[model samples]
Target: MARIRGYVEALIAELRALDDGDVWMLGGGRLQAAFLERGALDDIEIYVMPEIIGGGVPLFPATGLRLSPKLIETKALDKGCVYLRYNFS
Candidate 1:
């Protein structure tokens, strides 16, 4: 998983370079978990979509991960995409 570590390091470096008032929208739970397992993420969010996937690529792959999150905010969108924020505790 050297590639994953490189990505995590690069992302953390970019994060360290950001100002205090920047917002980064992170997607992919399993991908995020990879970074989180390396202690690279301090915050996370999951956007719930109204549309159901018939059968395609899975987002949250079946992984043995347990992440307890606190709902920080929820946004109701008119375009069938709802944004859900949570504190990755």
Candidate 2:
């Protein structure tokens, strides 16, 4: 987040030139929560892959933030991966 934080600061400057209708792509659910805590993000996407990760790095961590997700879409991607997008707002 250190490097990304620097870019986000840059974004704060360039955001003045935006049309207020642009969307920024971001990953990292936990970091998203941090941004939200700092009032940077309001909407989010939570994608659950079809295959289970066997004892690897986990996506969602215990951030002490709880939210109810509303299902927005589901998709079957390449390599037998199924994606589930939820509205975190």
Candidate 3:
């Protein structure tokens, strides 16, 4: 666990040093949550579809961590989908 944390820290540092544009993580909720927990993620973008599944993976896992990010923008897409953007402030 410690080694993995070190690796994540290094990766975040490297990305920050680049001074590039946004970094997108097309990973699952668990992976995103990991970065969020480490204060590495500045913002998050979520896409909502118009389908209902009985059971599936959550957008963000239950890690006993709670946060209230400011909603930056919202766009309605085709097929009844919506895009949500939130920033950690």
Candidate 4:
């Protein structure tokens, strides 16, 4: 756990040092959870599809931490899909 945390910290530091406009974590709930746990995630974008498969990996896993990010934007896409954007408070 300590090693993982160290790696996460290093990764975030490197990302912050970059000149890129925005860093995106495409997928992986666990990975996202890691960043969230470390307070490294400034915002998050979630895309909701029309189909539901009943069971699948959660957008964020249970880490005993709760967050209510401010909803910045929402857009309805074609085929009943939706895009949600939120920023951490």
Model 2, stretches more than 4 Å misplaced? 1-18, 38-42, 47-53
Where model 4 places Cα greater than 4 Å from the true spot, the runs are none
Once fitted onto the true fold, the runs of candidate 3 whose alpha carbons sit more than 4 angstroms away are 1-3
lDDT of 3 by residue, 1-89 (tens): 78877888898889889867989887778778888998889989999996787887778889998999999999999999999999986
**Considering every candidate listed, which one attains the maximal TM-score?**
3
lDDT of each structure?
0.71, 0.65, 0.87, 0.88
Pairs with backbone N, CA or C atoms under 3 Å apart (clashes), candidate 2: none
What lDDT would candidate 1 get against the real structure? 0.71
What is the Å distance of residue 46 in model 3 from its true position? 0.4
- For residues 1-89, could you state the per-residue lDDT of candidate 4 as single tens digits? 88988988999999989997888787678888899888989999988996778888667778898988999999999989999999996
- By TM-score, the candidates rank as 3, 4, 1, 2
lDDT rank order: 4, 3, 1, 2
- Give the alpha carbon lDDT tens digit for every residue of 1-89 in model 2: 68877776666557646888856767676566655555555456555455566666657666676667677888877877777766656
Tell me which of candidates 3 and 4 scores higher on TM-score: 3
Candidate closer to the true structure by TM-score (higher is better), 2 or 4: 4
Which prediction has more favorable lDDT, 1 or 4? Answer: 4
Error of 2 at 36 (Å): 3.7
